[model samples]
Target: MTLWPGLAADAAAQACPAGWPQWDAFARRHVQADGRVVDFSVPEQQSTSESQSYGMFFALAANDRARFAAIWRWSRDNLGAGSDKLPAWQWGRREGGSFGVIDPNAASDADLWFAYALLEAARLWQMPDYLKAGMALLGQVKAQEVRVMGDLGPMLLPGPVGFEAGRERWRLNPSYLPLPLLRRFAAVDPSGPWTAMVQGAARLATQSAPQGFAPDWVIYDAGKGFQPDSERSVLGSYDAIRVYLWAGVTNDGDPLVAAVRNALAPMTRAVVSYAAPPEKINTVTGAPEGRGPIGFSAALLPWLKATGAADALAAQEALVREKWQTWSRAAHPAGAAGDGEFNYYNSVLSLFGWGWLQGQYRFDAAGQVTPAWACAA
Candidate 1:
């Protein structure tokens, strides 16, 4: 599917600076001579395949064909290897120009994320090799994994760490990670295992916050609903909202849309009222829980855009604009040069929000898109 032309143009414009050459230079700097991303500026202080996957997709969005090709090559040479065949490592620091895995434990979500990223990249770049790699990764997960509590269905955690075997309850991120898996599965086999997984995740998410807003973290035992802990202002919630919005647009008649709509209400208010630099309030009425970087707000834009509620959308837009203005006035660098760890993720979100507001993507009168944001954009 072709991106909405207007949105594509807008995204391309927003991805770069006023001078195209400078933006191209920035893109080049992140990509190493070997084509892997080496920028410390990216979020999480790790060289995640997930981030590279996103970088590839966004590179396409920005119309950086060369960068896209480079990213594809890098991902293939590095991240495409399986666990048994050199198992992907998390980012780690090392001396003498070498890197190591931060933790031996493999995160299931990371693998799934890479798979989804590869699939999307394949579609965007029209490279069958990427698709083949994604399918192979999925096969690996299916061949060796078990049902994790919060994961909806059976999931494969990374190998050699053994964290996946002993855990009775799983941690909650629940938004970005699963959505891509579901989307990828749906694309390949509509009647496949992905639909069930997506529905299960939606159900689990709703159960976690029966009142609508989920906790920052939750524990889930297989066949049991979510066990809530303290709620925090998590960037994951916004990511979940984006996934829900995609589901809503894809299946408007689905009941989960309304459920998601209801859940996001309080989150919207919380960000608008109490969020501060590097932190978001946990409870709508309570003290600030902890520091949340820009990533928290980045997820908010897609949620607002999907909701299409004029008042809420306006509020979200204004809040983000205000935050950007604040950051700019404080002399923070634009596009992932902020003073925090999750800066790149947040920068992407903020840019996406700005692009949406500037009419990068097509939206209805209420500001909701008729299709998936990626598809529409």
Candidate 2:
């Protein structure tokens, strides 16, 4: 058995510092006092359900009970529209600069994250309300987001509407399905189709890439299996980076872990050959397009260390240090790091990557999270 990196004792000594400082600063800067996680990089400075969902998860991981409660309250009040159900996907400045939920469609990815975060938070913090909200939101997702395909069983849709490209074809984002997250969900509701989606997504993450890198999105035909998405370009960059991140951080004991690791071998090879991970790759040919940012390095930390790719892990670690000087210790004007604006996605990637790098948290085979502080528990 390939034993993944665990929370080291010395590392645990610095566990509090090993996590959430960047996101904390990020929350202070971008998350308004109103609880909105505003992405200042965008012109409209919109806040999506994705931002809110991820914030909840990060807060739980950071063990920031106060921030988690605040974010949930704001999302419930504004995004919920008093419905007490799934929050709308879009909020903040719209086309005419009006602030509200411009679109009410619930994003399945965000919904899943919200539910997963809630369940995990409840366990970690022993909060009943979080568990209640988590189960409620999960039921909503199981009813609305879950769909039955011809052969794929219950697959998750990108959103409540759209993404259905044709009568026989549907678009899917490979990066959206993190194995650990899916596995965690399956554990919560074993009778549901979450396991099927887990298997399907695992197959897609590996099968779609000839060179072992995942695509941002792909078309899943009922009979043809996975193909390149027509609406999006054939390149994988921002959206696909998480595919690797998800695979990298998964607990080693998972049955799907070895398969995902083997399927994403091209990423390992690329990180070794180029001395760091490529920013993007051709979805079909596995050809390198450009260099990735420091966050890519952060995303790879777990998988590298997991697979015993010591040199690759060491190389990416060096690159992460070189790319983000404040990576080791939170240093920045919150999102305005050096000349570039704060990358919301990059920060997210770093949370998982750097969190593992510092031994802050790791998922077990059953998908329960083991934070550094909770090592005994």
lDDT of each: 0.49, 0.75
Candidate number with greatest TM-score: 2
lDDT of 2 at 135: 81
lDDT of 1 by residue, 108-130 (tens): 55556556656666776678887
Cα lDDT tens digits for candidate 2, 1-377: 11224434442223433445666666776676667877766666678889888888777777777887887888888788225566898887887768888788888888888888889988888888888888888888877777777787778888768888787778878877877778888888888888898888888788777667788888888888778875787778888888878887787778887888888887888888888778878878878967788778888888788777988887887777665665434544533533252377676677778776665667877777776556544
How many clashing pairs in candidate 2? 2
| TM-scores, one per candidate | 0.69, 0.90
Q: Tell me the deviation in Å of residue 299 in model 2.
A: 1.2
Worst 10 residues of 1 by lDDT: 363-372
How many clashing pairs does model 1 include? 5
Listed per model in order, the count of residue pairs whose N, CA or C atoms clash below 3 Å is: 5, 2
lDDT of 1: 0.49
